[model samples]
Target: MAATNFVRGSVLKCSFPYVDRPSRPGPHPHYCLFVDSFEIRDRIYYAVCYGTSRLDEPLLENHNGAIFSVDSSLIKGSPMSMRVTHFVCSHVAVIPDRWVYRNFQARLDFIRPEGRKGDRLRERMYDQFVLLEPLMEYEALIAVNYVRKTGRPGLPGETTLR
Candidate 1:
């Protein structure tokens, strides 16, 4: 579509995690958010649109809807909050389970070595699942096959994400 289609009012950047691309068409004029909320798609996607000229931009920010509050976790050890990147469609699409697994697995290097790697896995799985989970049901089945059968267990129904 077009940015004018949805952002009729203003360019409010949410706190969603965005990936940096190498480069793109000069002044492609894309919106980046500082907040995290996938549901915002229903309201904002109309204004955002792109294709191959997509400028290698993050297209969609990777946010897993963190479980803990940044303020609550900021005391002894942990930081404020966590950032989870879900490699799923920004709008909607029929995605395969393997695709979801592959998507996240590609982002493993992106994961920071924090104290709780398990927590990060759950966050990544949840975020990715939120976008692809409802569209398909092979996640659990594929996960099992990837783990027990493959001799490599993953986080719940999530792939190893490696």
Candidate 2:
């Protein structure tokens, strides 16, 4: 997908050189939600945060990473068979302008709203993470809805959505 068309809820499989392993010598698959995207001069940038299955882990000392505890109810009716329950919202990443189109995979299934619980989570995630600019409430809601709503039954296609 083109960087110009990236949306808030898209789940992407990106290569992270930051994660290192003693036995592995290559980039690992870092799944993240496309929270925001913008163009600056000649390049386009995306703000993405890490998602994890370890809900027990702390936010840690990283100011760029924040983790949200998700539950089985959120994934039960969804399409992507993800095992994760927590999303690390503090670990915000700026997708390189060049790799936007190359690494994008598909949009996963999402859930609807869970009222105050969802609202509080969104507020907390946004407040803790440093963004290039202020994230609009609507935009945040869109991303949250994408994660909370059980919309479809398969990985979204490569076509640009929203």
Candidate 3:
């Protein structure tokens, strides 16, 4: 999917490279919700907040950031099969368009060499990465508003898109 197709509220299951662990074997695949997108010097960048099943009590209670929880039933056809997922609004990642495209192409290439089976695998991968269910507009608005209001620092420095 083209970066232009990614709008706010889109929930994508993509490989998020581990910034702290550069020596990790491969990209860490997970779900991320697109909260905002903008262009900088002709390059498109997306501001995304990560979704996790683990619930952090302290963070939810006293952290300056916001945490929005979504029941599994709210997410139609959830790939993660999580009973409850929380979006950490305070921790955001500004990802570049090229980073998204590069990882997508890499996944496709890895699955495309196996003939018919490869085709099926590629289709499933595409659905997860590009066509996954999206968060409701209201939910996205609340999350985005919290992030903005709290001025939570997003991922620092340039994200190393592996």
Candidate number achieving the greatest lDDT relative to the actual structure: 3
| Best-to-worst ranking by lDDT | 3, 2, 1
TM-scores, all models, native as reference: 0.20, 0.47, 0.51
lDDT of 3 by residue, 1-162 (tens): 125665444565644335574212126555666666655445555566666777766656643335555554434333455676676654556555544432321112222334225465444543443322243233334433443444432344332321
Better of 1 and 2 by TM-score: 2
Taking every candidate in turn, the Cα RMSD to the unseen true structure, in Å, is 18.7, 12.6, 11.5
Comparing 1 with 3 on TM-score, the higher-scoring candidate is 3
Q: Best candidate per TM-score, number?
A: 3
Candidate 1 Cα outliers beyond 4 Å, as residue runs: 1-131, 155-162
Q: Mind giving the per-residue lDDT tens digits that candidate 1 earns over 1-162? A: 213221111112122211231111213322221111112223322111111112212433322321111111212222212232222222211111121111111112212335236676445633543444332224334433333343422222321111
- Candidate 2 structure quality by residue, lDDT tens digits, 23-128: 1212545556666664434445555555555443234434233344444333322234455544455444444444443534554233223422456654444344
